[model samples]
Target: MNFLADLLDLILPEHCAGCGLAPVLLCDACALPLQGPARPARTAPEGLPPPWTVTTYEGPLRAILAAYKEHGRTALAAPLGEALATAVKAALTPHHLPTTREAHRGHDPPSLVWVPSRRLATRRRGHDALRGLVDVAAQRLRTTGVPVICVDALRQRGRVADQAALTARERTTNLAGALDVTSPTQIAGRPVVLVDDVVTTGASLAEAARSLRKAGADLLGTATIAATPRHHPA
Candidate 1:
């Protein structure tokens, strides 16, 4: 597969998802925004875990994510997953720096439960992009001694329409009762951080959180790569 990919890359040189630079999946200049401090998502829904995001869903970050998700540019997952890992680390224990004792003693961190995208969408896309992001992020986190585990705990209960055209309220309505916890035994009494690639109205995350809580998991907030920025009252 590596040989095939390399041959394909040489034949059809890949352009940076952010800039048009050749051979790089995402360039450093475009990655600067992704490395910026994680911030609260703008339009969080009630019952949604407190959200942490790396950047706004605009410009190069948006383009990169769209290319990875919509266009099946799976090679971009490494850079994008690194960004998500940074956000997860920032949100994990904001004030308390990890002690050398804890780091060396091998304290287990909470599980990261990724909210699976809609089944229909994943079927059409031929891959689960969010799951890929979670897998890579978990690997990076473990390398940093975070002891994170990735689990696919939630499943879509039914088909739902695309949320791009829906209002925030409509999104909430559409996602209500739309997620189910697949393994209560695995999640029960476990601390979990919900993860997603992008957050718009946060309806999907909220629904996933509800399912987790119902199944006895301790919900510990959320981390995402980007969020749709919200307007504040002047």
Candidate 2:
């Protein structure tokens, strides 16, 4: 670890995000609570595509994920990325899901695409937060021969309110016309997995899915590191 990272870790002190065990951000015992193999998560608006989460975004998991996104805890990205890979593997297992799951997984492994960060946020944050998890996830998926390819499929066209603080309808409006596909050919021939960090309203992924489909891509599903299980509009 770099001095800065070491300093950060020192100041914050690394503890298991779940159970507070030292020497690792996520200890085996804490990770053990995640049941079963990875599988596709049931998202609303049926017929769109299958979506997946490595584990429920609740309790200790929620704290860990929120730290990475909203609280500037970038070091946790690797673990979250691994969790996402686990979710993708579950999504791939036909037995774990309903019979229709085969229809999505049998052919080609979907190319993974992160919901392109808004230019403003990229500048403000100085790093593509979601990209870290996406890249590591692709690396993890490689172990199973699932091809996770990153393509600059979506581009943010303009400014939008923070999805975290917005109403669901506002989020939809904020993301309207926000993305454009520059290379449809790559995604057109295979399924594309829309990726992001948090899935509060899911407006971001939903819109990205819409844009990808409009560009003629067959989307397998979406995946994220953290998904707010319930929608309580603030």
TM-score of each: 0.86, 0.76
RMSD of 1: 4.3
> Global lDDT of each model?
0.82, 0.69
Give one digit per residue, the lDDT tens place, for model 2 in 176-227: 8888887788678676677876666677788888889888987766776655
Ten residues in a row with the worst lDDT in model 1? 94-103
Cα error, candidate 1, residue 152 (Å): 0.7
Instruction: Estimate the overall C-alpha local distance difference test score of candidate 2.
Output: 0.69
Where does candidate 1 stray beyond 4 Å?
Answer: 1-11, 21-23, 94-108, 232-234
TM-score of 2: 0.76
* CA shift of 110, model 2, Å: 2.8
TM-score of 1: 0.86
Q: What is the C-alpha RMSD of each candidate to the true structure, in Å?
A: 4.3, 5.6
